[model samples]
Each structure stands twice: as C-alpha cells, then as structure tokens.
Target chain A: MTGTGGRARYLWLGGLVAICLGLLALAAWQLVVLERQMRIAATENMIWVFGQTQIEALNLALALSDEAALQQIQTRFDILVSRLTLLEDGPQRRFLENAGVSETLARWRSGLLALDPAQGADPAALRAHVTALVAALRTKASLVMSHEWQSQATRLDSLRHLHLLALMSVLGAAVAGLGLVAILIDRERRLMSGQLDHLRAEKLASDLERERETSENHRRFADLIAHQFRTPLAVIDSAMHRLTRRSGGPVPPELISEKAAVSREAVARLVKLTDTALMMSRLERDAVLPSLRAHDLNDLVSSVIDDLMATAWDRDPARIRQSVQTEPTVALCDPMLTAEILSNLLRNALLYSPPDCRVDVSVFQSRDCIVCRIEDRGRGMSPEEIECAFDRFYRGSGHETLPGSGLGLTLARDLARIQGGDVTLSQRDGGGLTAALYLPKDDVA
Target chain B: MSLRYHIVQTALMTALVFMAVPAAAEDVLLTLTGAVTDGRVEMTRADFDTMDWHEFSTSTSVTDGRPEFRGVLMRDALAHAGAEGSSVRATALNDYVVDIPVEDFHRFDVLAALYMDDVPLTPRDKGPVWIVYPRDNHGVLADIRYDMRWVWQLVALHVQ
Candidate 1:
C-alpha cells in the first residue's frame, strides 16, 4: 500500500465492483424487458384475428357461390361475426380504432348483421350485399395488417438494441476483470521487491554497526596494553637500574634482595595484566567455554579464600570473617569459573581495605539464587564507577594507585554469567563496598 | 275452457323452472371428437351445467377487467367422454386452432366456462363455452403458453 501500485489496485478493484453492479442492474432490466415481450397482448394477436376475419369473409362469399344450405351459410356468417366482435371489444378494439379502420369496420359489422339465412333472403341480393361488404372488410384488414407489421418491426429493432447494450456491458466487465487481475499481480511483484530491498538495508546497517564495535574494542585493547605494560615495565626498569648502580660499590645483601623482590612483584603484576587482557578478549569474542554444574558454594568460597591466603605473606584468619547462613549452600555453576570469580572479589576486598580492618564473607540464599556476599571495610565506588565497573579496562580514577589489572571485575562478571550466574558491586551496609555473586541454586539438595 | 288453458300454461312454466335452464341448453355448444374410446362426445349447455362445477376469478390478456367464471374442470369433461390423449387441438368456430397438452387440465384448475359472472355466454360473445385458466390463483398460468390455451369461442376439442 505504498505507491502508485496501491492507488492503481484500488482503482481497478473499484472499477471491477462497479462493472459487476452494472451487470446486475442490466440483468434486472433484461428480465423486465423479456417479461414485457412475453405478453399475450401483442400486435400479432390482433393481426391474427384481422387475418381470420378476411378468411371468414372470403369463406362466406364462397359459400354463397356454392349454393350452400341456409343453415350452413348461417354458421359461416356467425363465425365471421364472432371475428368482427373480437375486433370491436377489449384492448384490440382500441388498436383497431387507432389503425383508422374503425369507421369502415363498424359499417362492415352492420352490413353482415343485416343478413338472415333462416328467413331465406333472395340469393342474388344476398350475394351482392356479401360481395360489397367483403370488399370493404378487405380494405380495413389491410390497414390493420400494415400497422401490425410496423409495430412488430419496431419491437424487434428495440430488442436488438437492448441485446447489443447488454453484450457491450458484459464485454466491458470482462475487460475490467482482466485488468484487475493484472494490476494485482504487478502490485504483488512490487511489494516483494520492496520487502527484499528493506531486508538488504537492515543487513547492511547491522554489518556496519558490528564492524564499528569491533574496531572500537581493538582500539581500547591497544591503549590498555600500552598503559598497563608501561607502568610495570618502568618499575622493573627502575629496580634493574638500582641493582646496576650498586654493582660498582659494596652491594648490600638487603638492597639486592629488596630490588629482586621489587623486580619480581612488577613481573608478577605484568603477568597478571597479560592474563587479564587475554581473558577480556576471549570473553568478548564468546570464546570462554565453562563446564557448568551444581556445586557447594561453601566449598567454592573456602577454596578461593584458602588459595588467596596461601599466596599472602601476612595472611591472618582475623582479616576476614566467614559466615554460612544455609546448611546446603549448593549453587548451579561452573566450579572453576565460580572459584575464579570468588577469588577476584575477595582479593579486591582484602587489597582495597586497611590491613587491620576485617572483611566479611557470607553464603546464603537470596530467594531462588545462592549469593556469596563479600563485604569490605573500604570506601565503596561511586554510582558511575559501579555502572561501568564491568566494562573491560574501566578503572576508577583513585584506583590507579592500587595494584590491579582493572579487568578483575569485568572477567569475574563475564565468567559468572557464562555459568548462569552474575556479580554486582554495591555500597555496603556500613562504610564499605559489597560485592555479591549470585548463582541459580541447586534444588537437589 | 279458458281456465283449463291458463292452468296448462302455468303447469308448463312451473316445469321449466323446476328443471335447469333447458331452453338454450339443448344446443350442442361443444363437441369432443378425437381419441374418445366411446366415440365422438357432444356436450350440450345442459350437459356442462349437470357436471361438477369449478369457479375462479382471473384477468385475461385480450379482455379488460378481471372476470369470475363458473364452469366444470376440463379434466372432468375429458373423463366423461373417456378421452385419452397427450394433447388436444381445439378448433374455434372461425377455424382458429391451437394444440393444448392434456397435462394442462390436471396441472391447473382449467375450466370450460359456461358462465361469466352468472351470465351464460353465447356465440356472439367469446363463448358458448370458453377455455379459462385460473390465472389469478397461479402465477405460472399467466404465461403465454397458458394464455394461448385460453381458447375462446371454442367449438370442438379433437384429442390427438
């Protein structure tokens, strides 16, 4: 319904309907005309009676010539009179009057009535009277016949015209019907082509959008690699420089050891940054495949905490308070991915908070989901930071001083989602940050 | 002697009144000649009067005004003559002839009319007997075929 095709379809359909209605009207009119034509009061009915009168008159004259009996002649005369009476009365009389034969016809009727066969009138006189009257009736019959012919011809002519008009209407309707079909076909083709063009445009737009997003991801990755590698490289270079400067003097063992530890820590930071960057790209490309299953949340959380503490030089049990609010703390997730996500959140809590301040870790059911809540005694993120905290390489301004790859929260959320779970950061109940990892609970337990 | 003559005249008039109209009913107004197993059957006006009568009102094409007709069903007349045929050719007194299918007698309540509005028809009129169809009662009887079957001044029915 878009263009000239739509308008043309309407025009064709409307014209077809109009033609059909016209055909119906013509059919009704034809029925009326045919009914009129089928009438008994036709010119032919009067013409037949007129011709019969002439025949009867001739028979009467013939009977007189043949010397027929009085009773026989009277019967013939009676039949003739009956034919004249048919002309004298009813709708036929009106027609005869119009044909200009009324005066002569009335005279003929009176003359025929004058004859009386039963009385035995003179033969010669009866012959003369019958002959003269027959001649007059002949003239009137001619007049009636001529008028009947003219009327019949006129009727046939009008009927022919009516037939021609009906035929023309039917022909016009057929042409319009064909035209309507052709227009419908053309409209269907145009609509199909239009739909194909629309689909092609949609595909083109989506391809362009995907390409822009991919190029943007590549650009961000390049900046992240440059910035993150440079800081760690500079620290490692500084450590190497300090060792080389002591190389020419009495190199104290403590100084060498301190420099070695500094160089190793920077190398470890670079390694972590490389791993985080690799994880970010893999997750973006949908390449991270996790084997998901039901797991005990308590086991996952405790293992992550144990592994994190084993890697810490000043690890203390008092630094983190653990609580399990449900007996069977089962969550449906990939065990390895869940451990990685929990390790990231707990490590962030310990690293960001003051050393003496204790962190709280709790496992409980929040409705149908199992939540591992990590609360830290550290300043929480602003709403803006929380909004984009899961965007790859998105770190808050003050977080630049902390030892982090800025991909921890993003990878943790991405991995958790892959296992049908999610991680969110919010302001804590007190004066810290809360990181909650939610997973679908295993109903079997 | 004059009182005896008056009594005799009175007796004659009373006898005529007690019987049906036998004055003009003696004439053989209609004759059925063909396909009658019992040979030609001649129907006088009194013969039509004695038969069971059917009545109907109808408008005619030739005549103006609707007229009520009193007559016997043509089927009853055909049955009385022991007539058996598919059709009958009715010959008018003026030699006008038209063939009518016998089925028409049973299909419509067709009448061989002896009277129109209580007046007996004569040859000077369109009947001594005229064939009339119940055109007003049946719409299909208004058709031209049935109209042609409304044979007037009908003198003879030759069943063929």
Candidate 2:
C-alpha cells in the first residue's frame, strides 16, 4: 500500500542475498587456503629429496674417480641438504612436530650425518657409506610418507568440515530466501484480494442505492397522480353537497333530480380516488425486491433507535426509551431494508416529539410477523392524516413547517411491505403518534 | 780419515737396523699432537687394544644397518693423552679435516672404532681407527657437522 512496505520487502530480500553471497565468499576463501596448503605439500616435503640423495650417493660411489661425477654428486648432496633444511624449522618442522614425527626426523638427520660424502673418498668406503645412507634414507622416507599421510588427512578433514559448514550456510540462505519470497508473495496475494473485496463492496452499495432510487421514483409518480385527482374530485363532491343543501331555489324537480345525479357521479369519482390510492399502494408493495434471510427484529430496532438518537434533529438519547418485549424476535426479512424501515419510523418519532418528552420503542411478536412500535408524546395526527401518511410526499396539514422531505412514512411503509411486513400510524390515547412496523417471522423449516 | 769412515758406516748400519726393527715390531695407527700438556700420544693398534674399551651399536655412513662398534672412547683417549683443549681437529687419511668441538666427545658416546661388527677394520673398510659417533643413540649428533666429524681412516687429532 505504501513505499515503506515495498521497501521493507526489498530490504529483506537483499539481506538474504547478502547472506548467501557471504557464505559463498567464505567457501572461496577456504579454497584459497587449501590451494596454498597443497602447494606446501607439493614443494617442500623431504621424501623425494632423500630419494634423490640416494641416487646421487650411488652414482658417487660408482664414479668415485671422475672429477665431473664428483661435482655432480656434491651438487646433488647440497640440494638434498637444502631440502632437509626446510624440515629443520618453520611450518614444516611444526607440521612434523604435530604429527609426532619430529624425533624420527631428528634420528634421520643423525643417520645422514654418518653418511657424509667427506667421510671417505675410496670407492669401497664410499660404497659402504652409500649403502648405509640408502637404508637410512629409506627408513626416513617411509617416516615422512606416513607423517605426510596423517598431516594431509588432517588437513583434508578440516577442509571437508569447512566445506560442509559453507554448504549448510548456503542451504540455510537458500531456504530463508525462499521463505521470504513465499511470505511476500502470500502477503501480496492477500492485499490484492482485500482490494478486490473493497471494490466489490463499493459496487454492491452503489447498486443497492440505484435500485432504491428507481423504486422511489415509481412510487412518487403514482402518488403524484393520486394527489392531483383527489383535489378536483374533492371540489366536485363539495360543490354537489352545497347544491343539495340549497332550499327555495327556483328550479324544477326534474332539474333538482339532474343536480342530484351530477352530485352522485362526483361522489363516485372521489371514491375512485381512494381506489387509485389503494392500487398505487399495491404497486409500491409489489415493487419490493426481497433478498430474504433470517434476522433478529429486536436487534434491528435497538440499532435503529441508537442511530436515530445520534442523528435525528432535536433528539436526545436520555429522552428515548426502548423495550424488546419479544426479546429475541427472529424474522425472515432483508436486514438492510428492515433496518431502513425502522430507522425512518424512529427518526420521525424523535423529530416530531418535543425534545424533553420521551420517545418509546418496543418490539413484540405477532402470530406471523414481529412488530416494532415507535411512539412519541407529540401532537397526534388526525384520522384522515393517518390514512394518507403512506402516500409519497404527503405532509399533514399544520406540519408543513417540519424539517422532513415527507418521504419518511412513505418509504417506511414501502420497505416494510417488501420484506413481508407492513407499517401503520395510529393515535395514542395520551396525545401521541405510534408507528408500527411488522416483519414476517422466520420460518424454521 | 779411514777411522772416520769406519765409524760413519757403523752408525748408518745401526740407524737402519733400529728403524727396520720397530717397523717389524708394531704399526702406529693414531698420532695425537698439539695442546696435550702430557706430551704427544703415539698409539699403535696393540696399544689401543690394551686400553679400556666401550661398545655401542650404531648406523654408520660407511656401513649398512646398525653395527656394533668396539673401541676406546674419545673422551677417555683425550684424558689418556692428558689433552687440554676446547676443540679437536681430526684429519682423515684422505686429508679431509673437520674441527670437532670437545663438547661432542663429552656430550655423545663417540668411539674411535677399531672393530666394527666384531671385525678388525682396515683402510678399505674406513678404519684402522674410524671416528664414530653413536648416532643411533643420540639424536643431536645427527647433522652434517657431526657427520663430518666422523672421519673415516682417521689418522690424527690435533687438539687445540
């Protein structure tokens, strides 16, 4: 969602790569050390030098008379001595010491001392010395061989251990890298799904709002037609009544009979207005598209009352009372539409009543529907006003100054009927209005 | 003048007899000179056999394997010669010379070997008196310097 989170993910991945690279570098360093050790093993050991010394001594004994041969033999001995010097000290001596062969090496040196070429010059003496030297060299060579074997074995073992450690570290880095990747991918997937859910929720809310607007328009058009016809029909009916009551008018009986017939037709037209209103009300009820599910009416009433207390004009929670007589009243209704209906009724009660006077709400169960009643200690509506309350845009006389769109009662009744419910406004004996909303009970089967 | 000639001839014959008689009697195998407070030690092979002997088995450059050497110790020989010196210069019959610190005689069982593996040594065998160090017994004597001191056919020690 933010650069910070993305940056943290990259940082984690970078750290994993760095760890792997560090392990690889360690492996490379070990290899370099191993190469150096191998070089020491190859160039500095005395076994082969002693072998060369043996060959040179044999040659010296065989060619004792030749000056050039003697020089070559001397040179070979010098070379052997130089190689032996490597074993006398430094890392090679330390290696021999660690291998428990230093004493043996010292003894070999002692034998070499006895076999020095300067000791005798005669061929017979030289041959005897060379013979002894060969035996000593052989013994010394074997000692060196076994010592080298042990030292090399030790070195190889440590090298293997270092390699194993490097391999395990590399593997650990790999697993950690994979784990980080998996966690990041999973988080990304969850974030994408969350975004999708948010978009879907927005689309559903908009769809519901659009459908509600279309339904409201249909109901408003029908109410407009009914209201427009009611006025003309009322005027015709009043005029007939006025004419029928007039006495001493200079008119024939037949004329009076014709006026009476005109009055009856006008009254019938007024009755048709009531029929038109009923037909429109049915149309409004039928317009309801119920996506029904089981819900609790008591919880709905409590929640709507709470909402009204907060949002309704001139409403205070302290002045409102609630009681769920049915307790856990379950109903088969669309919860959203049911909540809308209860909210409308509760809002009207809290708005119309005096600020200090209490508005009371109660939820009770009927045989087929659960009913919630919102009663307020306000000026009660007349019977005619109560009958016309369901008509869209119908504001009662002397109530035109009220802060409402006059669609509250109309929407309330329309929403109620759609959810297999109904709403009615009645006068309380104590001078208040009570609006009842009925919701169909949930079917257990 | 005839009397003088007769006298000189008798002296020459006597000198010849004396020189010839000792050569037939004994051979001098080793000569020790220089810095001996007691005087020079000229020992023949028979004289060396008469001295107290020490023995050790050791590998030598002139021989195969370890051979038991029987001889007088150099330290004892030096003492017999009443030698006073810090160092001994040993010369092989081939004239290869090496300076051997007296400490070597004290520190190691060095033998002026007359017999190797119970056999009397000859010049061809790197004897009559081979300077031998018990190399097998002492690891410190195992070096080129010490090896050079093991002079074969050792003819003289000039202790100085």
Clashes of each: 0, 2
TM-score of each candidate structure, all chains considered together: 0.66, 0.33
Q: Candidate 1, residue A183: CA error in Å?
A: 7.5
* lDDT, candidate 1, A205-309, per-residue tens: 999999998898788778777887888789889988887876566888988787776777678668777877777777878888987677889888888888776
Candidate 2 local lDDT, A311-360, one digit each (tens): 43334577778863635688888887788777768767866777788888
Residue pairs with backbone overlap in model 2: A110-B142, A129-B61
Q: List the residue pairs that clash in candidate 1.
A: none
Tell me the lDDT of model 1 at A226: 84
CAPRI-style quality class for the chain A–B interface of candidate 2: incorrect
Error of 2 at A83 (Å): 4.0
